[model samples]
Target: MALPPRQSCVDHEEISLGEIKIKTKDPACMCEVEVAPQHCSVDIKSVVIPIYLKFVDVRCSIRFKTSTLCRGSSNIVGKEILHGVSGAVGPGQILAMMGPSGSGKTTLLSLLAGRSQTNLHSGSITYNDMGYTKALKRRMGFVTQDDVLFMHLTVKETLRYAALLRLPKKLSRQEKIQRADSIILELGLDKCKDTIIGGPFERGVSGGERKRVCIGQEILIDPSIIFLDEPTSGLDSTTALRILQLLHGLAQAGRTVITTIHQPSSRLYHMFDNLLLLSNGHAIFFGRGQDALPYFSSIGLNASLLMNPADFLLDLANGNISDTSIPPELEIKLIQSKGDSKVGKPPELAVQEYLVECFSSEVAFRDSSVDSPPHAKDVILPPRREWSIGWWQQFLVLMSRGFKERRHEYLSWLRVFQVLVSAVVAGLVWLHSSADSEKHLQDQVGLIFFISIYWAYFPIFVAIYTFPQERAMIAKERASDMYRLSSYFMSRTLGDLPLNLVLPLVFLLITYFMAHLKLTVGAFLLTVLSLFLIVIAAEGLGLFIGAVMMDTKHATTLASILLLIFMLTGGFFTHGLASFVKWIKYVSYTFYAFRLLIKVQYSRSQVYDCLSATGCKSIASARVMADVDLNEAGPMEDVFALLLMVVGYRILAYVALKRMNTAR
Candidate 1:
């Protein structure tokens, strides 16, 4: 692609500032959502930002001491999404980052939120006292485009999860609940406190409601600074305005709220007290929103459209340099403005403070006279206590949702049902011929094939479905440091168990008896082992797919192809063929697993010892395997290898997941 052009500045005549007058209609209004451009205007004679230390406390200030490359600077030539853009936002103010859809607005938000810390080709970011990205991250909370919520959880549970995971134990339980409840009410989600924030499949609340819950979850953390990336992206204009209004309130209460928005409605356009305009990953304007037009006019860049100036800025940001020309005076204006040190507060605090002030202006809101702690009410609950509940708690939750999500569709269920039916058919076909040594081999092969199909295919299927859903939550939570990735992996793995165990175990047990595949107790135990291996391996497999492919359909496809390759290459299906593709058999997880488990079925080693010690017995009465031949190679070695395979692949899967890191 061609590069952004470096054009001469428009070199416009500077207008005298003595005639400029400030508008003052609504003194109470600042950057509130409802504030109009006409309601509040600053005098042109002085800087809107005066150097203030308090501003340093609330806004994470990013500054480049040297002059920055503007929209068409000759020194700037790269495809970087976010250029050396510097701006500031403090407590109780709104700094709406306005740019086109892809002008690195979200990218800049991500950086400010400390979600990602890749060093800029140049610049410095300071949050509170910390200069590095790491320190800034700890004090900041970020909300992304995707709301990472557990659909199975109620609003209360979701908030509770975040609280427990985020806040240190020093905080009292009451405080956490109060904190959570406050966020719920603050976000205007009190009415849906018990509702589930559902997804496309799990119908519950509206998209806007779910989006609010996401913001609420982050709010519960009560960070010193909160950064939201496109906080109002997907909602309707009214809903979006309401959400922004809620954020404005949050800012007024001494919280810092920095968010990115694109082509906002005219009403939303004027809501920003401070605007950071970016084009081509470069800053064009970084000051009051209304000043945008004058900045353009000063640059001699034409912007006659009645639409939001953000749109005009965005077009200039993403458009071809050849078609666009930067006015000379605009560059000088941007360069001059770059030196202003103080940035304003987050607008969220203003709204929040306004509400607090409105309600408590007359009464002592903080005094005990306002309201005492309410008395606790008795309630009957489940007999099972929370302490004793182990992974089983998660297991039940995951299993219930998995079944509900999968069971409703004929298309989904058919895949599961077909496997079960195939198992039954195989059992009936192989049952009558499996007492002799050759028959024993056939029986072993039957079990291996059936088990391989289940283990190989099921994990891929689950991975395909579960990864996309989990990714949203994982990425969001990971960015927040809600929990360690290992913790999440453990919980999710444990949670999916009860459901995963049932299918493979049920099919194998029923089929085993019907096929009469060496009914030794040892074989039965191995059957359980086989199930465990498959399920765990399958989980690992699914994780690999999910981590590598963000798109579920693509992940599913990749997983399926991998499964086919591994299963076909498994020695059980075509043992002699392995000479040509022997490496394949070695790598095939199913091959090793099924071979190991099937050997146990065929050998009945434990049963053989018992029978031999008794000097054997009549075949009919003893029901011992006649082919417990000493000449046969034992399945013990194969079984151990399979067990190792499970461990090996599981570790590999975890490594893949870690490598496919999230924004953090």
Candidate 2:
């Protein structure tokens, strides 16, 4: 007998006369595994991944920590949420986790991704392969339930940046592009790869395209297991079927594909060979789909032949064991019987003994029961050298997105234009006035305080307006481990620069010219410098408040309260009244700086240019109490205070952000 033709590195095997060769491809791990068991063959020309998932355990949670405020609502009590549960998944087989809407099905997905941990009291999510689940996030890929996109970047750029941030340099230029192309086509995003993904603010790709792009990013890394929250959700029936077919393709090619889906159509249900039914955070049925009837029958429910067994299983799944539909005793007996089979034997026991025996020879995937690597640490973080793409790349991408987001709007310089108009008007009106009107002196004090308080609202708006929308995206991405919190903070701090710089510069140029009391070249420069510090303080304050508050309403209310405090203790409005709250002024950035700027610009009779906002003579008669020259208002006194405000608030915001952002 002749031997089979072999093109691979390994030697050939003796062949039957009518043998058929089949091939399959993997774009992420970048390899192919062939089989000749049947007439059909899948000859994979290329793949991106050479590795596959050894094991995967994802746990999604909705933490209801109900202390006092949220305790009464049945919705949020100590629901134990997705009760103590476990499932095993590897390559090739589809573990279709089926359940009702509130059965914690989605929560299980989130938990497996390790996105939520607080509401979850005790559990261990271990990925035997790829090594790190927490610190080394590059190893896992998560496709969230929503369509999140930048709206500015096209599908190609979106995947490109994600790959740049994830793939190592060793993955050559050609390799990266090839992998990206593979993922692009793999998800059927070829047509819309150049299209922009849309958001409410900007228009681009459709929902299905957006979801594919999100998945494309994870595929770029060649993760061991790919997790989808609900890939078929909201999609049309045809599109939904296609999405599942894509997942089916991935599983067949030897990549672990785990997804949480609601009740699917008969066509969709038939696609799944394995089933995991969850009810009330518990797994009631887990085994082959065909075995469902036998499994239920063993528990005393003889489901009629030709009946849609899923319906009976689901109907019984309703926790209504007390109802006659499923007598309480029978329900308890059924549940107890099922629960008893959950352990001792490995999860693979659910499959027939013969299938287990044949798995070793028939299965093409890397084993899921792989043990921990000898050098592995519990904390899974990448080495420092892996930054061919990472925070630095994302920082640049976010900053670019921020710029584009602003550019399409009425220019960021619009505020500057408004200030310039105000400056021209103020220069024309107050061309001459630097005299002894005590009433004028009092008016200036009120104006300064009002500006201090009013500008306080700007940073809050910047933080809240920008952050709330991003809150949803951040949570979604963080759950997938796409980027870290530190990177977002750093990017945001840098990204916010244009607005901060532009807004304050305009306000200062206008206000200084309008209030021309006295001016020196040194005083002019120092005033601009002082204005910058105030803006920095405000930005930090806004981020801090935004990070702690979940809702914009609460953030706005808190911001208003803080603004009142900044104005009162700022030494501009209530210097005398501050006697009761004097200590507040010491900690208030506005107080020290407001006092400093006024003293510097209004202390003496100094000559001024008409172009200067605060004109030729210092109103000496207002208060001769302090002869401290306008040029020498003593900045050292508040310099430390300004630094403290900036440094203190930023550190606080970053810390708060760390606790809040669990998406990455």
Candidate 3:
């Protein structure tokens, strides 16, 4: 069976920027699709539609400051990485950046995408004659090589959250889902739409499908210009080709797509409409992809028949080309030796200088214009509006996602069993101690300190992994203008509260009755409330540590050291120290929690036979409080301190996250 050739449903006609008029050859067969001035689409058939996108012409000469050790002196010297390298990527075209490592491919893409925070010595990046502002950045998307996704989320759920955060707030929930569905179909991910985006331990979609889902995420925003850094990295050859084909299709649909690729296949090399070849941060070639062969041939470096053009070009760029008369093995050795010799300059440096000179005389350079098209004058881009949803809405969405992620990650059966076992062990150790016995006072105090330590230590250690694990995702989403950092931080802090409180509540429930300290309802409730506050304070401390360190190992080590210091000074291991050092207990939340637990359990009680061997005596709870050096600090005062610590640490965490993100 043969498939029918697709026919155009509408007559081709040129439309101006503000006005679009479509004339159909057959009215009955055509689907009438209205177009908006801000964005327009012409439906060729029910299945194929091309967007009338605003063409973006990007031209920039970017540089960054770097420090190098001085040769003779101990001082550092500053240098520039990029040296005014410039090029343009026009609309409906795929501009592929190819070069060796450290060739500034990713740096150039970051600069063009307006995501770099490094110093720009001099450059101007404009879209359709307008300056590249925050407005334009929101309309563009940059997909990093590494896919940062919520592994617990399904493909559809992932796209839905992306749409909810990135799409205009005016869109209804159903509309956003529909948009996500459309993108899923376009990316050919409909089959795996229901599958979870699994991680190292879980089985789910293939690598190719995951990459497509990443692309689908960006496409949900309907960006006019898209930048991808090594989208084919870590994929098989067949998968890489399929990904390139998808990018090519997007370009054909009127998107200005730019990507950095390394060592592409021959078939993949031909897919690019334009090529930006670079060497040592210098432009070797920037023109049509087809012109590369002729350009190289004219320079007496013609590629052999059936040779991969990309490899040959890279070889030429890297100064590894050999004459036909020279043996290939000897030529490689000679090139290696030349690179090793450090007398005058490396072979690559000489090659870069030669290419830089040759590029000045290339026909592409002589004929190419870095100016915007004339039609850009009449084109009216829509006024830029906020791309994020409302604050409360962002909170709700992030809260939902956080809950789902924690449910899968932190609330496992192993975690539950560990908590239960620890609680049972603590209960057995301090099984039904009397509050009025002076001999049992130490045991009761130990039990209270252990309970405080359990609540404080585990939550802090568990939360140490929170920010580091999500740091990449936070950077990606923040770069995409998805939501405010405050909303995300607040929602995550609030959302995890329930789960954080659950284990502590369970531990207290088992220990409270088994130890049999206080039977009054008010006392039990106060104890529970105080323990909850302590857990929150511990969580905040963990968040602060994670945010400042941004590395799991470093944060965990620092947190362990800090927690150990707090535990030592928590009024359990030591009774009295120098006044100068005794103030350390004031800073430890464990001190307050332990003191409050003791006061709540033994307040208004009395202990008989306090004397060791001289005489019998009766001791009041107030005297016991004075003996512990907590007479001045009541239960309410400790509670207040714990509450303050919670708010203070969370605020500090927020500040740290903002600073780190800004620095990045």
Candidate 4:
């Protein structure tokens, strides 16, 4: 057999397959030849192998500490989440996990998918009999219950971005787009591929379509194993059935699929080849789905003629059969007999223990074809896979997506209207003031100070919500090894710059000429630049608050407090503070921005007339600067200070976000 043609080491170079050597005279073409039996062989054509993941005696337990502070004393306790639950999922098979609400179904799934790291995990999870590691994680996909998608993006755009971030770099841009299109068609989202995935305020695709788009995103990598948590929770019966059918097709095409389902219909239940039933974190049944009915029957439990098998199992697991429509006398006898078997034990507890014992005796032995424990030498853990794209590519893709999302979600015409209205109101309040009158000077000072406060307050409030909203999405993507944290942070910061600049600039343009304080082109441009910088600084501060706090309401409150502090020390409300508290003014961005605006407007002007009757004397711009305490720092120095604050706050925000994601 002959191997497929490989890329030449150089133009017109000869390659020998048997010898695993390439002959080339060009020193630049120093490519080395390597052969592997599964991918490429010197004597045979390319061979492909499918991956199947299996776990044996897998157990996970989470220890959480709860503290109560009463009378200045603390108490703590710990608990386990999952017991020794074990099962296997192979190629072309679907494993459906069914359990009551708090039975650790999602916890077990998280353990298998490596999504939770703050747990005590034991036993073995293997891919093709090799130990599971980061390399294998790259080939597996996990879909969360909630659809954490960019709500502003179309289905096609979302999948395309996923492809760009996840697909191998060897694939060209066009190839990646084609892959995304294929997945869109496969998931039946072609009908709404171009529609936005709307959120609470926007009306876009249906719930079913959004769920399909979520699945389609994970499918871009062509993963060998896919795990989903409650994929059918919100959809109607028909849509639920369709999603299961889609998973069935994927399994048929040689992918292992697993999902946790709640109260699935009988038709949907039968689609699963295997079922792992749990109660109180104990695996009660782990075998073929068809075997569940017969196993229960052998244990003296029979399903009603028309009862759905799923409902029967769920009722049996939950110990709720006595609450059903059985006859009163029969129900009493059933309850009496169940109580007699276990005296003081709860029915659910008794049933769980009995089922676990039976499953161990009957099913474990039959499935123990593999040895009880394999030697360390027998378990081959693959090396971690390299990232699909480099950092530059990741940054570009993230920045582009951020820009598009912000344009659709945040930068609306309504925001423009609000800014215009505020600008017009400010203009009307201080319309056409002159430099000669003392009252005009006071109004001009008030206007500049208000401008600083308004830009600072508005941008900070808006930007504070960014991290709280996207933290889940960021955590998910990071777990999948999609991109670097720095790339995402930089992209988001840069993406917001356009809107931040535009909104503040518009406000300045409307109010700058309307107030008639600074007539020179130089002064007007300087004022606009100063306002833009202040807005950017405020936005950076907001990002820091959002990232550090990670809760919208709490972050908002903290941001309001901090902004209040900055506003008080902003050189307008108070000219001098106690010596001990004067340092706060130095730290406040608003103080610097306000001083810069004041200096830009008055530093070069000479007062020709005075309207105040007390003194009534002409004064230079120097006297005006001394009156406002803007002489401490030059305009350039204040500008530099604001720039430093922006950079410093953004870096802190990035660090906080990185810590939060890794803390789990």
Candidate 5:
């Protein structure tokens, strides 16, 4: 006889039958103990800093300015979302907040997580009796409803990078990798460890697996409190249960977990240690999961055995209650209150108000218990430390991660094809033209101007997507204090540099030789140098645009307008313009870049012969340059101007990012 097939690595049992030939770790038993993280110097007692969270009368309101055409005036409108909601949960407890759509579940969660920017009318949110601080961020982990992940990175790569940037410097790289592997095994992700975390566009891990990856990343640093906004929002029942089960394990390990859930099955519902039922931004019930039904029953609301308690609660919250469940007193009160102004409210609002009153009157005392002083052991505040990795280390790690995440987008077949096509077309259009001819020399200048404008146009569109696409992920990581903004900004700029240069370099190599514009090494090198500056300067402008307007659509529009303006004043289109706008040419990066290109290829000594009225008269390069106004500035002057744009735009971008972070 053979032993039953092993189910999971953590929990299993031996079969009744005599096992076939197999040697277990302990030849007598067939079960394996759960694997622990392999991070160095990790003492569970010291690391598991349990957080006892409590919030009192947490209320949030938002204000917006509106214009009224009738009055022809502006008005300030305020709407209260979360109205005096309160709850508490301690270590080793799973507090599940359930409510229907627009019931303020997420709003409450955001306020508790300290991520909300709305006005708090009155509330006190504390952990271990201490207020939220920057240091506390390191001890908390937040998993938003949507899985924000690098779609191209494998599970192992994603988790390992999280560990590398998030884990303490005390842990070696190998130890960090081992820790990631441990989490992979613990979360039962070993099978898909090498699979890419897919997005809507790609096929890879399943939804359950992706959620587990998010959990794994948050837990890599052993956060004391984990806040999840509907971790199981969009998954199937089985997959959702698996995520909750994983979260249950975290609670069992003495970590506090709070999550917002929409609806759960009986089995999933029972797993919650504490339940917070909300309806219309009001707290209806806050107590043990088992006590919720009892409390509802005691309040004259009962569900049939065949009905799910969650369903019944939702029905009550939704004002879909049956006549049998309506208590005589509530019904009588409803009748007597009909003449009252409150009767004009929606049925759900009335019902929600009734539940709020019932819960508050009977169990308002429970809030006192949650507000009681916490134990001294729970007062531990994680020691605030600088970046777990040094500044340079963070830059390297971020750059490496950025490179891996974006390599596919940068080197996609379509992009390579586009570059190749553009190069081939340009090469064929000006194939083997003689430099001594005036017409060919003029064509070469036009070609140089085309190069400048093409590089500028292409890079701006490409760079606009960078910040917008990663905004959510960056916000999440920054909220957790994973890395500095400077490190991330530098890494993004530098990591893109090498790959961004690839297409331009390849284009120049192919187009320069085919066009036969200049044969000298110095001329070719200068051509490359000037084109490279244009690319860099354009990229910096794109970064600035992306940072300023973290909306890809808006950024693209603004970039188009700005680039068009630069092209018009680029000195190639027109030499004369209005005084007010003529200064734009001096400031336009493309203008300088175009000037440098012309300066590098043509010199005062060079002359081109053209068949004219005087029969093959020689025209000096100086006169040719004067025709287009390229001779106004020397090569060094244009280089200096481009250098300034290159550095200045990036600085502005960095500042914009910093301001955006602060705004958040």
Candidate 6:
């Protein structure tokens, strides 16, 4: 095997402007090649496929619907956010979008990254001068503003799963693992590779390492274009500088890197190849980073030599020119532009309008020395493969990940202790109740009702928090085209089933034997089966509620109201309900479960002692069940009803997740 030419062997042109040195790579030798260590030999392709991203006349506006009470109708009010912003970034360069908060930096980045835009937006965003296609989705990567990761997954585990799911299926599993190991080495994450990525409560990797892990996940596929939203946010100056250097290295490897930056230090500003300055959703300047200072000075806005260039640019965008030394002509130009916008606007608004006009009027800036981007018809895109893995493969991988991440939470000592303590207390309260007398029979009824309601209550609350807690993580993964939504949904559902059953099964075993509900094997199995069905049905309903609400507090509130209603109509609390509410029992799965338990324990031929106005007499169990309305449904009928609920609620939850994915 032959190694590619080294970086020193490639021809390069250097230009000096003031204190900044700009290095331009030769177009004929643009491909980037990497040499591996002695033990490992995989290398980046010698010929790179480049992506040129260009957007023209981009505009975005949001509509706010305001109600007019007097007219009994609503009016649509529109506010323009991004106004005709335009720029272009090509291979082997970093384009940095900089502005203060709410200046449309993140919004423009989202649009370019192909995220969902619910508002009215118009723009021509092209790659290689071509429109977006589904194939392009997997070819690009997006890192969100916030780090979305499994808190329990070690750094190596996170990257390994990403490699398994994102890498091409043609590669063997061992090869994919090796790729992950290489990324860990490249990112200098070897020290903390085994450490878990912790959250608010747990101690884990530092902030810089977490951000690097997020980047590693995206780059696992070697994306042609990568979009990052505030990747340097919440980090110290030194760490942020290192991150910028890493991005620069990626650009040098022939990847198109575009990122949103809020406020950068002086040292960080010079690292950018191109800069897009925005204010109030309007572009103030679009040109090379080094040329910005010269362009501003030419327009008679001069900054102090000691002042940070980033701060100076930010002040100009913010319409704060108190520290800036403006020439007489520029001051006059600001006054002349006052009447072009609103009549009685503030001085700051006037200055911003003047700057917007200044950039728009610069023809030389619009037609720089850069060559025109190639047309789509002239460029040949590589053949894109289908999803790296099949649906079942995705399900298995996701299931494995979910189990590894959630086992600790599911089998925690606190939860185990809680279940055990509750089981013991309930068993002692109704210990060894015989079915011979009416009082004992009533005690048995209470035990059966407790089994039905207690099991339902435990899982419903727990599962309601599932989707709400993982909404961000799910969205992030789905956006990356890592796997189908169905794969994730199924894996999430099945991964939890076994772990979720442990405590419940233990609770039932302890209570059933201690309370002496049934001695026969068939009866014991039936009781356990009934509780399992109840758990599945209840968990499905909880998932549905969480998916619909996607907020912890709201989902919990709705689940509480819904479960309370179901329990009330579960054939135990109320018998003489109004006709309108009588039909609720048919829909409440808990009602079916309770009926199944009653049928399992008490047979139709069983008799109980009763007393009414005379000596004690015998009463048939069938008559008692009839009075309570539990005898209407057969045991098999109850099982089918519960099974139907288990399927129906799960379907609803999945549909909800699909809608959310589509919305994004």
Computed on alpha carbons, the lDDT of every model, listed in order, comes to: 0.57, 0.59, 0.74, 0.76, 0.80, 0.81
lDDT of 3 by residue, 120-230 (tens): 445555666666667565557789999888888999999988888887675688888888889899888999999999988989899999999999998886677899999
What local lDDT does model 6 show for residue 400?
A: 98
Using lDDT as the measure, name the better of candidate 1 and candidate 3: 3
TM-score of 2: 0.71
| Top lDDT prediction, candidate number | 6
For model 2, residues 1-664, the per-residue Cα lDDT tens digits are 1233344322222222121121222221113434443322223223323223232223334445444555654445544666555556655656677776787776777666555556544555555444333533444577877766677777887776666556565566566677777788878888988887767866788776776787787767656567888788888777778778877886776666778877576677777766777766666666567876665565444544344555555654553222224224444444454577654432122221222222223332233333443322222233431344467766776676566555443244565576567556655545444534545555555555555554555665666555665787777666655556678778777776676766666766666666774556888788777777777787787878777785788888988887778666665433355356777767776676676666656555532243455644455434432322355546666677777878888888788767765533
Q: Which model, 2 or 4, shows the larger lDDT?
A: 4
Sorted on TM-score, best first, the list reads 5, 6, 4, 3, 2, 1
Worst 10 residues of 2 by lDDT: 20-29
TM-score of each: 0.66, 0.71, 0.85, 0.87, 0.90, 0.89
Could you tell me the TM-score of candidate 3? 0.85
| CA deviation > 4 Å runs, candidate 1 | 1-84, 172-178, 293-420, 423-448, 464-469, 518-525, 541-569, 573-580, 583-587, 604-635
1-664: candidate 4 lDDT, tens digit per residue? 4546444334435445321233333322222224343222223111112455567676676665555556565544556767777888776789999988988899888878877766478877766667656766666888899998988999899999999999778678998898899888888888999999999889989989988888887777767689999999989999999999989987876677889998899899889999998877777787788989887777656765568899988887786655334334434555765768557566555556666666777666234533322221222224555688999999999989988888854568888889999999999998997666666677777888889899989999899999998888888888888888888888889878887788888888889889997799998888888888998999999999999999999999998898888788766766667788778889999888888888788754355455556544433443435534443445788888999999999999988987895533
Collision count for each candidate, in order = 29, 40, 0, 0, 0, 0
What candidate 3 gets wrong by more than 4 Å, as runs, is 1-74, 323-342, 364-371, 379-385, 606-634, 662-664
